[model samples]
Target: MVTSTLDRASAYTAAAAVLDPEVPVLTIEDLGVLRAVQVAEDGSVDVTITPTYSGCPAMQTIADDVATALAEAGFGPVRVATVLAPAWSTDWMSEDGRRKLSEYGIAPPSPPSPTTGDRRNGPVQLTLGRRPELVACPQCGSTRTRELSRFGSTACKALWQCESCHEPFDHFKAI
Candidate 1:
């Protein structure tokens, strides 16, 4: 399909609007999975995305959604590239995404400490010296939430329970 610049832009918009299957409350862009979007002169669409983690199962679904959205937008010859280099970080998550996560009953990731090294620089390493960060409860907006488990329904999240509401919720853990 021969798409104009405007149409290409629309395609990008549509692709960006694709929501993550694992986290329906967050879009691919919101999860920082969307890396690049390029519309070739021939009207072919190229989308580059990075997985949240190496073994993240949502990657395939995300790629498929990108292709489907672009095709629906009248863009043909769509190519979805999975870029592994420069690992994804919660830091890449947009402010709007954080807000949406919070509203969806998931606590957003806390900012990295200044003294710590950048996790993106090397392979994902779980550090022993890593200090536990406080997470607010999405239910009653209380800071008195306790982590029930390190792993949540998804790999990107941790199970947490709100003390005030006694509600169980997922917290988007910092990686």
Candidate 2:
């Protein structure tokens, strides 16, 4: 059976709806990883994706998943391209994505402060009063939590200890 251009486009859209394996709460689109889908004149499908971070081990799996999804949707000769530029930022995360992250036991990034200095020059010297509020626990919704480690299972996340629940969970670090 031959598929029409419109049908192929719709299929790509549907396939892109799948959520990231690591962060199931946010769909690939919501996370801004699914960049573009273009159907070639000969019916070949090209998918563009931007990794959330460099050296992310999940990227290979994500590419494979994209290919599988397109193949399942009846597309042949699917190409997945990884574009790295304009690095991903927590600000790119959608409001719905943030909510989903919290629901999935990962605390979303806290809002940026006006006085937060850029640390590129040197170590950030935050004034005591300018420190951002602690991220609340996703499980108990308590603000009482302490940083266990700067790095969690992934470099993009941090491990935090929730005092109220006595549980250790990963928090999506603010980029």
Candidate 3:
């Protein structure tokens, strides 16, 4: 069975539709976790994914979901590979993903700050006390939000409350 370009694209479409277990509003592709998909001549499918973090608990479930989705779409022997090297970054999240997050009542991660100095050559600098990030309230769009906890419902999110709205919401932390 020779796989054509259409077969690979179909496989990718199937795999990319799998939703994140933690954030159901965003598809794996929208979250930037669905990295690559390839359909072999043998009719087997291969997928490569990068987790949001190294120890993310949702990776296995995500892998299974991708495999299942592809299998259901008539692709057999689906293989989902996890790659941690080059690490996943919040920068990879699609604009649509961020918009969906905001609509889902979770504040999307702020844009990553520009890197300064030569990170490769020098020792890492640690700031002991940093000011709290100014996170806008997803509900009220107010910047007067305070972080309630560093850890939220998940490792990737932080719990925060809006001073104006008095509503507590999860904020997707910038990686």
List lDDT for all candidates, in order: 0.85, 0.77, 0.87
Q: Count the backbone clashes (under 3 Å) in each candidate.
A: 0, 0, 0
> Candidate 3: how large is its RMSD?
3.4
Task: For candidate 3, give the lDDT of residue 165.
Answer: 84
Q: Report the number of backbone clashes for model 1.
A: 0
RMSD of each: 2.5, 5.2, 3.4
lDDT of 2 by residue, 1-175 (tens): 4557796677568657867888877888777678778777666788888787878877888888888887777776888889876566665667778888888898998644565433223433424452445889999999999998888988889999899998888999876
Full ranking by TM-score:
3, 1, 2
> In model 1, which regions exceed 4 Å deviation?
1-8, 112-126
lDDT of 3 by residue, 1-175 (tens): 7789999989999998999999999999988898899999999999999898889999999999999999899999988899875567777788899999999999998654556333223433446775668798999999999999999999999999999989999999876
lDDT of 1 by residue, 1-96 (tens): 555778667877988899999889889988788888888888888999999888889889999999999988888789999999888877778889
Candidates, ranked, lDDT? 3, 1, 2
lDDT of 3: 0.87
Candidate closest to the true structure, highest lDDT:
3
Model 3: residue 104 alpha-carbon error in angstroms: 0.5
